[model samples]
Target chain A: MSSPAQQSAGKPVAFVSAQALRARMHDAVNDPHLRQSFRGAMDFLMAKRAAQFPDQGELDSLRSLSESIRQYSLSKLPDLLEQLEANLTRNGVQVHWAETPEEANAIMLGIAQRHAARLIVKGKSMVSEEIEFNHAMEAAGVGALESDMGEYIVQLAGEKPSHIIMPAIHQTKQQIAKLFAEHIPGVDYTDNVDALIQIGRRVLREKFEVADIGLSGVNFAVAETGTLCLVENEGNGRMCTTVPKVHIAITGIEKVVEKLEHVAPLFSILTRSATGQAVSTYFNMISGPRRGEDKDGPEEVHLVLLDNGRSQAYADEQLRKTLQCIRCGACMNHCPVYTRIGGHAYGTTYPGPIGKIISPHMMGLEQTHLLPTASSLCGACGEVCPVKIPIPELLIRLRGEANSAPHANPAMVGQGAAYDPKISLLWKLWARLYARPATYRAFTWLATRFRALTPTQQSGWTAARTPLKPASRRLRDMVKDRR
Target chain B: MSSPSHGANTPRTYPSRPQAVYFYGTCLVDMFVPEAGMDAITLLEREGIRVIFPDNQTCCGQPAFTSGFPDEARRVVEAQLDLFPGNHPIVVPSGSCAGMIRWHWEKVCAGDPALKARAEAISARTYELAEFLLHVLGFNRKDEGPATTVTLHTSCSARREMGTHLVGRELLARLGNVTLAHHDHESECCGFGGTFSLKHPDVSTAMVSDKVASLKATGASQLVTADCGCMLNITQRAAREDQDAGRACASLPGEHLATFLLRRTGGSPCGDQK
Candidate 1:
C-alpha cells in the first residue's frame, strides 16, 4: 500500500482526528434527514441484534459458538480447501487457489483471455479492493465498472472507500453531485439522495446488460455443497453473478466453511453487526452456473480462493482469529478513532482494529508499524464484536510481535520505544517512596514543606498538560485527625 | 484497622462484596493528591462501609506490568493481595491503577491455582475510585464542587475497560462548583498510558498533542480527571505549553477528583481543592 498521505489526498476524508470526527458526527446526528438515514439504520440493526438472542446469555453463547467454529475452520483450512475444490469441480464449477494477488490477477487475466472478455460488470467486494483487481483487469485492456451505488460514487470520485459498508460516507450529497457532473457528463446534477440513487441505477443497469463477464465476491463458501453465498441490499451482486454468460467469484481462502450449518450462525452475527439489521435483503446461494431449467443464471461459474498471506496467518495461533472476521465493518463504526479519520487515512485495504492487526502481517510489519500504535487500546471493538474476537488484546499482542520483527522502518523501533525505562526514570524516587505508606506519608510531609516549589511540568509529563500542585496534608493524616 | 465485618452473617453473591474493603491509596493520593483518598474514605464510610487503609498498599503493579515485567508485577499484586486478605473489594481513587489491578491481576497470577483464586477474588471486587462512589457506595455527589465549568478526560483504562465515563459525569454533576462539559474527544486516551510516555515518547508526545487539542476544544477553564496518570500527562503538557509561550492559558493545569472534592468542601475547589 502507498503512504497514508497519498491515499488520504485521493480520498479526502474530513474527520481524521477523533475530536473532529466526534464533533461532525454529533452535528450530523442531530440533523433530521441524516439522523433518519443513519440512526434509523443503526436502530433497526440494534433491534435485530437484540431480537436474535433475547438476552445477553444467548448472545454470549452465540459468540462463543461462532468463535469456536471459526477456530475449527481455520485449523482445518488446508483440508477444507481441497474438499471445496473437489466438490466445486464435481458441481461443474472451476476452482482456482491463488497464493497471492499477483497469482490471482494472472489467473483472472488468463480466464478473461480464454473467453475474450472485454467489459466486466463488478459487484462491490473488499477482497477485490484488497487485490486491486480493477487496476489489474484494466491494465489487461478490460474495463471494470462497479455496480454498487456507494462503490460507483467512490469510483467516479477517483478515491478509495471511506467506510466498508458506506463506501462514500465521507462525501456529502453536494460533493457527490459535483462528482457526478464532472464524471458522468451531460447529466443534470441533483444533490437529492433519491435522485443520486436513481442515477446510479440507470448507469449500472446498462453496464449489467452488456457486460461480457460478471465478477463478484463470495460472502461465504460452503465446503460440503460447494455453494457460494453473496449477501447485499442492492441486488447488484445478483446481477453481477447471473446476467453474464461467465460468472467469476473471488474471495479469500478463509471465507470457506466446512458445512452449511456454519454459514447461518455467521450470517446471523454478520448482518446485525454490519447494519444492525436482522438479515440482508438478498442472500444468494449459487451452486454452479446455469444448468438444466435455470431461468436466469450464468452459463459458467468459477470460484477463486486467494491466499495473499492468509495461510501464513493460520500458522500463528495468536493471529488466527483474524481469519474469523465476517467483514461486517462493525469495529470501524463504533471505533472512536476510525470514525474521526475515516478508512482512507489508514492506507490499507483493511482499516480500523482488524486492519491494524492484519495489515502489518500482510504488507510487511515495518511499513505498517504505525497502524498498530494508532489506537488508544480501547476495548470498544471487542465489546461490539459479534464473534467476540479480543481485537484490542490482539492489537497489543501484535505490538509485542512487531517489536521483535525485522522490518523496513528500523528507525521507528527506537522512536516508538522512547517510553521504555532505558530512556528516563522521571518517577523513580516516587515509585520507591510509595513502596510503603509510612515512607510515602513522610515524603509527602517533606514535599509539603516545599509545596510551593513544585514545578508545573516537571519532566516528560510536561508534553501533555499542566500539572496540578500536590496537597499540603496526606489523606492518612486527615483520617488520623478525624479520629 | 481490620474490621470485624468478615463473619458468616453475610451471604456470598457471585460478586460478593468483602466485609472489610481496603482502600489502596495509590501513589498519587498518598503523595500528590492525598485528599482524594480522604474523600473516598468518607464516601465509603457513609454507606455503612468499614474502610481499611492498607499502609502496605503500594502501587497497583502498573509500572512493572506496563514495563513488561510480569514477574515483578506479580510480586506487586501478590503484596497487594497479602495487604488486603479475604474477599474484600480493593478500591482506589485512580481509575487507571484500579483497572491495572482488576484487569492484570489474573494475567499476572496465572498458573498458581491458589494465587489465581486470590487474584480472581480481588479482581472481582476491584473498583475504580468513582465507580465505587457511584455504583457501590451510592452516595450521590450532586451537592459538591462549585459551579465552575470543566472538561473531563476519560482516561483510556477507565473508560474502555472499567466503563467509568458516564459514572464520572454523573458524580461530577453532583458537585456544586462544577459544570461538566464534554471534551471533543473525551473518550480518547490522554496519551499517558503508563510507561507509554517513556517507551514511545515521540508517539506519546504526538498522542498528548492530540489530547491537548481535544481538551482545548472543550473551551472549559479546567481539566478534571479520575486517573492521576492522565492528570500527570495533561499537567506536564499544559505546563510545557505554558513555559513555551511564557503565558498561562485559560485552562487549569490538572486537578484530580479528590482535589476537586476537597476544594469544594474547603469552599474553593477551583484553586485549592486539596
Candidate 2:
C-alpha cells in the first residue's frame, strides 16, 4: 500500500477517494490521448466478445448456469473454505488465513524470511496488487518482479495497472517502446507487439530461473479436489509456479467452488468474455507441492486466503452477487463511463463497473462512494456481464446505502453524502408540492408565468447548451382552452 | 376487463383494445412540450378510443427515485397512482416516464406492502406511446405526409427497462412515406440520466456530443425519440453545436414520437374537430 505521502510523490496518481473522483474524471476527459486509447481498446474488446457469443440462447443459458453456480458456492462459502483447507492440508500444502491486507502481507513476508528468499517472480495476481505486495517486499529488502508482460511494463513505468485484465491497456505500443528503451539495460526501441513480447520473455525467463519463491493468483480454488486452477496465455505462470524452490498463491476467499465440475463453464465464459479467447493456452491445476515422485515443481506450496472485507459482501444477499465476478473485464470493456475515463481515474486496484461495486466492499464506501454514482446507469455493464451480476441494481443500492441516515444500522461506510439535511428537506418540499394537485398546479402556473426569470447561467445545464425556459402554458390548461 | 397476457420474455399482445385509455402527460410534456401531450390525446381519440386526461397527474417520481431518494419518489408516485385507479391502460407520451412506472415503481415502494401492491397494479397498466400503438392498438396506417428520412433515438430506460425501442422501430416502419435511417451507435445512451447530467457535466457533455455526432452521421432530415428528457438534451446540444460552428441551425429539432406520429398521420384531430 502506497502511503498518502508516497502516492503524492509518485508520478502516476493512485489512492482515490470519492471526493477526488470528479476532479480526476475532469482531467481524464480532457486528455484526448487517454480517451482515444481507452475508446479504441474497449471497442476492440467489445467486438471480440460479441463474436464469441454469436448465439444469444447459448449465452443466456451459460450466464444463468454461472449465476446459479456462483450463488450456490457463495451460500456455502464458510463450509467450502473449511473443506478446501482440509483438502489442501491433506495434499501437503500449507493454507494460511488473513482477515485483512496487512495480515496477508505480514504472513507472506514472514514466509519469505523463513525461506530466506531474496527474489520472487509473480504470475499476474490481482490479489497481490490489492495487498501492494511489490511495495511491501521492496520495503523488506526482497525483490518482487512481475512476470506478466502487462504487469511488468506497468511496474517498470512506476505506475499501477490501469486496467484489470490488460494492466497496461491505457498504454500504446509506442509508449511501451519508449518505456522499454528507458528502463531495460540494452534494448532497442520497437513498436512491434511480437518483439515486445520477446523482450519481456527474455527478461522474465532469467528471473524465473533465479527466483527463490514463486507467487501466483488463483482463478478458481476447487474445494473438492484441493486444486488451485490458474488460467493464463503466457508460459510465465508455469515457469513461476514449477521452477521456483517455493510457491505461494494468494487469493480472495470468495474464489472457492465446491466441486471441480463447476470450473468447466466458468472457465469457458471467463476466457470468452475476457479478450475473446475460446480457452487460454494454459490452465494449471496445482493440487500440491512437489512430492518425491514428482519431477519438476516447487518443494513446498503455500496458500494465503485473504478476507479483506469479502465476508462483508457475502453477508449481504444482494451484495454477495459482486463476488461472482471472475475478473473477466467484460463489464469494463462495455462500460461507457470506464471507456471515457479509463482505469487510472478510478484510482483503485480494480477499475470500471466491477471496481465500483466490489471496491465498496473491499475498501469501504467512504473511499468508493462516488464510484457508484459515476455511471449513467446505462446498464451496459449488466447486459454484458458473463456471471449476470446485476451491476446497475447494485449501484442503485450502493447509492441508497451511501445516502442512508446516520441513525441507520450497519453504520454504512460513507454516511450517505447525498443525504444532507438540506437536500433531504428540499426533496421533501418538492415532493410535497408535487403530491398535492393544488400546489402542483400553483407551482406550474408560477413557473410558466415567470419563465423569463429562469437563470441563463444555471450551473451544469447552461454550460454547453441554451438556458431552459418554461412553456407559455401547461398541457392541462391548454386542454381546457381547446375544450 | 382482461389484463394483457404477455410472458416474461415474450412479445406482449392484447386480446382486445381497451375502450378508454388514461393519458399520463409526463411532467416534462405537461410543462415544456404540451403539444406532444395534446397530439397524443388527439391520436388516441382518432383511433376510436376515449382519452381521459387525469387532471391531478404530475410527475412519475423518477427524478427523485433515481437521485437516491426513494421516500420522496414514493410520495410523488403514490399521488399519481390514485388518479389512474382502474383497468384502463395508462399511456405515457414518453418512454422514460413510462419506464419509471413499469420497472422501478414496485422497487421504490418495496418498504410498504400496500404501496407496493398499488405500484405493481399501476405498473401493469402503464405503456409507452409507441408500445401502446404497436402492441395494444396494433396500429398500422398508411403515411399521408411528405416523403422524409428520420432517425430514432431510443432512450436508455426505454431500450433496457421497457423494451420499447423495438416497438418504436416497428411503429416507425408502419409509416408508408418515411425512411427509417439507422445510426451506427443507436443503442448508446444520450447521457441524460436525470441528476447524472447535472452531477457530472463534463461526462454528460461528451456523451451527448457523441450521440449528436452519430445522429448527424445518419444524415436523416428529422430525428424522432420517445423520451422528452433525451429530446431536451439532444436538441439543446444540437442547437449549441450548430451555433458554435457558425452554421445556420437548419436542422429540424428532435420531435417526440407521439407528435411525429400525429403529424405524419394527418395532424392532430382536435384541429379538424374545431
List the global CA lDDT of all models: 0.69, 0.84
Worst 10 residues of 2 chain B by lDDT: B1-10
The single-chain TM-score for chain B of candidate 2 is: 0.92
Q: State the DockQ of every prediction.
A: 0.22, 0.53
Task: For candidate 1, write residues A1-483 as lDDT tens digits.
Answer: 121122223343222433132234334433445433433343444455546556666666677777777878888888888889999999989999788889888888888888899878889888888887777777677777789888887777767786677787767789889877666646688899898888778877887888888889999888899999999999999999999999999999998889999999888888877876778998999999788988888888988889887766677776777788888887776665564455666777787778877776566654665566566565667766776677766666555444432435442222233234532243444445555556755777787767888876645454444555776766666667777
Task: Write the residue-wise lDDT of candidate 1 on B111-190 in tens digits.
Answer: 68799787777777778877776666564544544467888887767765666767788877777667777765455556
TM of each candidate vs. truth: 0.76, 0.95
lDDT of 2 by residue, A138-164 (tens): 777787888988998888777889888
Give the range where candidate 1 chain B is weakest over 10 consecutive residues by summed lDDT: B1-10
Model 2: how far is A327 from its true place, Å?
A: 1.4
